[model samples]
Target: MTMVSNEYGKIITIEQAVEMIDDGCSLMVGGFGGIGSPPSLLQAIIDKGVQQITLICNDTAFPHIGVGPLVAQGRIKKAVVSHIGSNPIAGQLLHEGKMEVEFSPQGILIERIRAGGAGLGGILVDIGVGHEWLAKGKPTVDIDGNRYLLERPLTADISLVYAKKADPFGNLIYDKSARNTNPLVAMAGRITIAEVEEIVPLGELDPEEIVTPGIFVTYIVQSNGVDWKWIWE
Candidate 1:
């Protein structure tokens, strides 16, 4: 593959991008199941044998989809996710005491990530007030005669994201529902790597269509496309 570069010099190969992620690092992945996930990047990580990862994402996806293969292969030490029902391996690992799982409400999970990107300490919400599982060990705040749980902001050492199109500068556009959590996750990482199906020249993308600005992306890798057959099986 020819090296794509711009004045910002953010474009890089998948191997070079994955090298930035060390063992035991916190990783925030953007996707709703397999839709928006960066398959080539995730597969590269698996091949690199990076271990003890703390994965933060919306769901575990299916065993052969998205981040689920990482979870199934025991690559993750802990997972902070909204749901793991789609991937039985995650449940099995949790039950077998091989992995740690933190459950977060879908809305709150993205909000917490948003807060991290915005550089806020945390956010207060009442969604899990009376639920023991959600409220356990959490600090409560009282205001206007009501109590709310203080959900701490979440940030990651590295974030992996998939985009439908991106410029060399990393301005990104997602395909429909695949955009879920990617914009938020893009901002919350110290180093954000975006795998894109197409990399257009700078200024070719309309400003209004770019969901994630180039400033939030540290690197951009060309994608090798995902095989959707995994989903049907």
Candidate 2:
């Protein structure tokens, strides 16, 4: 069994943060690909060798980017994602029957995650009503003669996020495009950990600039910044 620190403060080491994730746990990762992904945290989890992760993310990214290494190493047992086109490994795993992938329309996927965080049972959408795969196994209802599929909420056992800056209390502000899906992902996890490039003192961050309030963050880890070369290759 892994020994996790019992310290009460939200600031923790990357190693300590990854310990909270066990094998077979559901993980929500915030990123469009490699851009906003928490690289150091993800690498730490890979080093720990926790397997059978259920990953929820926007995409699988490239083989060397974002959550791609996890998929390449067969760490992921299932994925709930918008697409896997960017990551050939993920597509291969799906085609070879080694992994299960649940495809959701991009907009609806994020909405489901938001609904999860907001404590809603689910949201109704008409986007996939006639589609064979998207409509499968989902219940539907008609309101005012318009039919909609019930897209259930999505929540994870743990969530990993990246931020541009963070305070001791865990208030976060993200970099431009890197902010994608992170705010919503932060709210939907039972335990949300943020990997930040810089940690500032409390009140140093302008309130107007804070995108994710400290209330949603459970832990903060200092980032060992990503290698852009690997992501660009």
Candidate 3:
């Protein structure tokens, strides 16, 4: 079989994209309650059964959607995320000592990812300065008597994102609230794979509308399969 040599210019299959990942990888998944999650790519990853993956996402979503299946499948060894309220599977796994979960404030979490993309060491925020349990030995600095905790950058081996539209060069546009967290996740990965609903010609995407430039995207996959509906949806 002839492989597509230029990942940015052409669309790759879900299998091709999934095969790029390895076991024990740190991954950033873009979504908020399954809105911008990459279902086909995730299903591919689930099929691959890559174990010990550490996922960073806004939420775990439902047990059958987004990163929840990975948790239910016992593939995720650790997760660094903002909330697990939507998915009881994550909380159950954590309680069972089957998985480890790291909590983060939404703003602080995104800033850490942004810092990594910008090549910054970290950012200072007072979000958790007073909570000694949350500080966990992080050094604090006083800015003229006010104190703040230093939150370090977050980078990942792989990033999975979903887009409403993408050009052949991988420039992306997202649909409404679905755009949440995807742009940042795109930049924080060493290898970013985008799952897009539509792939158009290289010059078709409007410059201003493209939230994520193709420069940050390493590969592209056309969206496939039926949409996974949440239990509440």
Candidate 4:
């Protein structure tokens, strides 16, 4: 088991955060592309040689960014995400039958994760009903004379998230557009590790400004402060 402190949201090194995970673990990673990815923690996983992971994220990101490196490094065996257009490596693996990829609608994907955190059985939606390819073998629910697909909740052994700032207690505030899917990702993991640019004192974060509550976070790692220039810029 990983170390747990009563001190509440203790800040640890990326190496220590890596110790909490093992090979073949299920992970939910928070990011749209690589914008809000946890670089230090992701690097730690690469360094530790963890492999055969099942990843849940919005996308695989570009080949050089975010969890894309993990894919490039062959650490992921299966990925549940919206698309792999950004990462040619992921697409290569998918087509080669080297990786198992599950495609889910973006809205349904996040909602399923949120449902997992909320302890729900699953959710019902009609996004893929008519498309037999999308519907596949999933069970259908008829509610109020309408049919919908039963989307199962997705929970993970651990979740990795990036935040702009965090209090010692683990309350987080993301930077601008980097906030995507992080709050939901923070909630869906059995244990969540946050990598943040700054870790302030416990009271530094205002309650109203806090996006993800400390209760959802198990550990925190300060960011490496490397500037990630946006491709658009």
Q: Which pairs clash (backbone N, Cα, C closer than 3 Å) in model 4?
A: none
Error of 3 at 92 (Å): 1.2
Instruction: For residues 76-173, write the lDDT of model 2, one tens digit per residue.
Output: 99999999999998999999999999999899899999999899999999988988887999999999999999999999999999999998888899
Ranking by TM-score: 1, 2, 4, 3
Residues 86-171, model 3: lDDT tens digits:
88888899999999999888888899898988789999988878887999878898999999998889999999999999887888
Using alpha carbons, what is the TM-score of model 2?
0.95
- At residue 202, what lDDT does model 3 achieve? 68
- lDDT score of residue 74 within candidate 3: 87
**Candidate 1 TM-score, true structure as reference:** 0.96
Each model's number of backbone clashes?
0, 0, 0, 0
Model 3 segments beyond 4 Å from truth? 1-10, 228-233
Tens-digit lDDT track of model 1 for 1-233 = 44445778898899999899889999999998789999999999999999999999999998888998999999999999999999999999999999999999899899999999999989999988998987998999999999999999999999999999999889999999999999999999999999999998887899999999999999999899988975665
Model 3 steric clash pairs: none
Global lDDT scores for all candidate models = 0.93, 0.92, 0.87, 0.90
Please provide, for model 4 over 1-233, each residue's C-alpha lDDT reduced to its tens digit, 9 standing for 90 to 100.
22334367368888889998899999899998888889888888988899999999999998878999999877899999999999999999998888999998899999999999999999999898898999998999999999999999999999999999888788899999999999999999999999998887767678898999998999999788655776556
Alpha carbon deviation, residue 148, candidate 3 (Å):
0.9
Off by over 4 Å in 2: 1-8
Output the better candidate (1/4) by TM-score: 1
**Backbone clashes, candidate 1:** 0
